[model samples]
Target: MSNPLPFLKNETPVNWFWVDVSTQNLRVMKAAHETVRYPISTALNGLGERRNSACTPRGWHQVRAKIGAGLPANAILRGRRWTGDCYDASRDPDENGHQDWILGRILWLSGMESGFNRGGYCDTFRRYIYIHG
Candidate 1:
């Protein structure tokens, strides 16, 4: 059996992926393909592992878990809880003053094979940050 996800192909050429925390962008590169880019959110002050703080970690990571497969974009999520509503960027952030919900797509990340990202200093999954559409 094979993995069903588009990004989870086995034997696919090894591609490099990186996220720039400062610019809130994700980039993926394959040998001959153009680098695909996506907008992302990081830690507000770039600190802490608590909920409600939009601080994205700075380091190397892989797409640990890709969720909401075949789901519509802009889906609403609260407390990791999915509400029936789908949201766009135009939506007001004030509605949920705390805790940015993971919607649309979820790439649950585990730290990479090296550096501060591997251990207690900065664990991606433990921080509870999720990327959405």
Candidate 2:
């Protein structure tokens, strides 16, 4: 609820991504000022650090990897690999029936805090938690 910038005083003030699970919002902060904001959807199971919980982990995180660079919009990615299929809503609404495809780009996140979301079963990267659109 307060400015998170103070917590990052020791860190560089280049750019930071903040996700508020309560409001389902993601904000891009530059020098303590929000440059962009977007609506985000978190796991239905809510927040947790355990694996297979289908929950969003809380704690500091950094972008570990950037996926689907230069790829077309709506590109279907399965297992983090491009399937060469683009989603066309007009064709069939349930074309990808029973399957969830990671569309667009993926910002793979790695938790920075140890024993919270970084190591063991609480590992966010191992849990495959990503910010994708």
Candidate 3:
């Protein structure tokens, strides 16, 4: 596998959250700690940092904030603000609906690297990308 991002220069990330687009998994790694991997579902639109693409952004990112704390499961959120309403998937599941169904908890991400995942149309923060549950 050739270098995906040449800017990385073969350097290893100390503590990072990596989302594998192909496997639909997110790997969490911390220094001196066991690596953990979680099954995740990315956008069906595919990968890109461009705004409004509905695609998952690439490159370095940091968890800017944690939302939906102390909130009940299936709580719906709009514009990162809780709508105070919950959508029960069991009752009225998406099942191929137009809505993205951003429910439960959300971990807002901000890009650390400029000109890639950050800045202009490539900005993930501006794109409203989140690790949502």
lDDT of 2 by residue, 55-97 (tens): 9899889889999999897998877878898876654445555
Model 1 per-residue lDDT tens digits across residues 8-65: 3454456876666667787777874647988876655775433344556655567677
Better of 2 and 3 by lDDT: 2
The lDDT values for all models are 0.63, 0.84, 0.83
Quote the RMSD, in angstroms, for model 2.
Answer: 4.3
State every prediction's TM-score relative to the real structure: 0.62, 0.85, 0.76
* Prediction-by-prediction clash tally: 7, 0, 0
Better of 1 and 3 by TM-score: 3
Q: After TM-score superposition, what is the CA distance of residue 76 in candidate 3 from its true location, in Å?
A: 2.1
List model 3 lDDT by residue over 37-64, tens digit each: 8999998888888888999888778888
Tell me the spans in candidate 2 whose CA falls farther than 4 Å from its real position: 1-9, 91-99
Our tally of clashes for model 1 stands at 7
Q: How high is the lDDT of residue 57 in model 1?
A: 61
